[model samples]
Target: MRALTVAEPGRLELQQRPDLLATGELALIAPRVVGVCGTDLDIIDGTIDPAFVSYPLVLGHEFAGTLLSPTAELAAGTRVVVEGIVPCGVCAECLRGDTNRCAVYDEFGFIRDGAAADLLQAPPHLIHALSENVSWESAALVEPAAVVWRALTRARPQAGARVLVVGDGTVALLAGILVRQFKPAQVVMLGARSDQAELATRFGIDLFTTDADAAGSGYDLVVEAAGAAAATAAALAAPTRGGVVLLLGYPGAEKVGLPVDDLVNGDITIIGSFAYTRAAWHEVVELLNSGALDLTGLVTHRFALSSFEDAVATLRHSSGARGKILLDL
Candidate 1:
């Protein structure tokens, strides 16, 4: 079996590795499409927090795959997407349905070998079977979709609310798309890259602009998905009185100056979300299966497993509008 292995920070290669087999309650899967995002870049450059990452890891978590063998309830070749966060089911947080906050923080593509390989193994309970009609590209996006879904579920934007999404990346685009379900009066995106305007429009964004001031203020809901301190600060300032601000991005150790007076005087709600819970993952899978959400158009690039270097290069620096970059295994 061949796997894209990041031997350490700043070193990545497609190496021949031992085949992974299904053992115990684990099921074997052959990853078909894997999405790479800013997190993957952080993992490759060792810029993410040390506590959340393990070195010499496979470089994928957002992926869709097929069963290499039948499980108790599914047949071989069944399309599936698995939850990245492997929680301890016995933990207090898990008992409370807060699996994202499990005391034991084991996750795929972080501490565990992920799906960026010919074969991967995961516990059957963590796997959700996808509909046969779901495209591999769309299924591959379920993980990240679940992340955004979890944050939105927590924020609970009301109908006709004004929403502002900060960032032009995949997560931000997903946020712009998914926020529509709440029937917001309008969805505006503040992006650093002008090239993303067309793509944002396709995602149902009413406006996409590089100017922060043009984005204006007084949004009922503001989502910060750029994973930057500047974006975070903008999000905090965009919300109206009693508005909700959802922080869905991971900016690492960077800190933003808080508007303490405004937050207190305006009665704002600030929510910082982590990874998705099991329920959130299931909901996203249901949305994909039922055709309520279609994200295949977000896929803009694909490369073969052997072309891992080229994929990383494109991910690091793409001259054109980039959405989701996938590895077709």
Candidate 2:
């Protein structure tokens, strides 16, 4: 098997490795599409938090693949998307259905080798079968979609609510698309990159602007997905009094000054969401299977697995409209 391995910080290689065998404990999968995000860039650049990453790691977590062998319920060659978080089932958090908050923070593409390789293995319980009609591009995004879905579910935006999404990246775009299920009256996106305006509009966002002032305020729900201090500040100020602000981005140890007085006076509800729970992952898969969500068009870039270097370059410096970048196996 050929794997995109990061031997250490600032070091990455597509190395050939021994083939993996299917077992009753772990299901073997041939990854067909692997999505790369800022987190992967953080790993390659040695910018991610040390506690969550391990060296010589495989560079994939967002992916979908085909089963290599038959399981008790699922047959061989079934298309599937597996949950990346490997929660300790015995932990208090897991026992209470908070798998994402388990005491042990093990996850694929971090502590464990991920699906960036030609072959990957995951616990059968974590694997969810995909509908035959689900495109590989859309299936590869289930992980991030699940993350946003969990946050939105927790916030529970009401019907006809006004929403503002703070970011133009893939996560922000996903939030814009998923929030529509709540039947919001309007969805506005504040993005730093003007090139993303067309993509945002394609995702059904009512308005997209580079200027925060042009975005106006008084949103019933504000989603911070840019992972920047400035974006967070914008999100905090955009919401109406008593509105909900969902913080979904990771700013990597950066701290933002909060408006404590305004928060107290405005009676705003701030929700900080982590990764997706077991239930949330399942719900996202259900949405994909039932045809309620189709994000294939969000994939604007694709590179062969062997062309990972070019993929990383595009990820870092693409000047044009960019959405999800995927590695095709």
Candidate 3:
């Protein structure tokens, strides 16, 4: 099998690996598409928390694949998207339906080999079938979409509320797109890059601004996806009194000052959403299956697996409107 791997921090190579086979509870899969995100870059650059990642790891957590073996009702060659977080079902958190916070910490593309390869070995219970209507590229995004879905569901913005999404990255763009289902009166995006206006507009964002101060405040709901300390602060201030602010970005190990007094006095509800739970993943899959979410035009870039270097470079130095970047197998 050909796999793209970060052999160590700051090192990446596409090399041949031993054939992976399904054994016991595992199932073999041929990854059809893989989506690379900022987390992947952090993995390659060794900037992610040391406790979460292991060396010589394959670099894909967002992907779609074809099942190589039939399991239960699913047929062989079925299109599928496997859950990245492998939860220990018996754990206390898992039992409570908070699988994202499972006591056992194991996830694909992190502690285990990911799907940035010709073939993947996944647990059968974690795999979910995709309807034929869903595009392979769209299916590849299920993981991240599920992440955004979880965050948005947590905040539960009221119907006709004003929503503000901070950041121009794929995550932020997705947040703006998904919040629409909640029937927000307006969805405004605060991005750092002026070039992202077109992409944000395409996602149906009502307004896009690069300036946080001029972007206004008192939003009914605010989402922070820029993964920066300043953006986090902007998200805090953007929400109205008694409104909700959701933190979906990862700003690394650095700590940022928070307005603790304002949070208490303003009766603000702040939530830090992590990975998706089993229920959140199911909701996203249902939305995609029913065609309620049109993921079209969201994938603005594509690269061959062999051109992983170019893909990584583009991610680091992208200038204009950028959406999901996929590595096609």
Winner by lDDT: 2
Q: Give the candidate number with the greatest TM-score.
A: 2
What's each prediction's TM-score? 0.98, 0.98, 0.97
> For residues 206-262, could you state the per-residue lDDT of candidate 1 as single tens digits?
999989999999999999999999999999999999999999887768889999999
Q: Which lDDT values do the candidates have, in the order given?
A: 0.92, 0.94, 0.92
Worst lDDT run of 10 residues, candidate 1, spans: 247-256
Off by over 4 Å in 1: none
Q: Report the alpha-carbon TM-score of model 3 versus the true structure.
A: 0.97
RMSD of each: 1.1, 0.9, 1.2
Q: Over the stretch 56-104, how does candidate 2's per-residue lDDT look in tens digits?
A: 8998999999999888889999999999999989999999999999999
What's model 3's lDDT at 263?
A: 84
Residue 230 CA error for candidate 3 (Å)?
Answer: 1.2
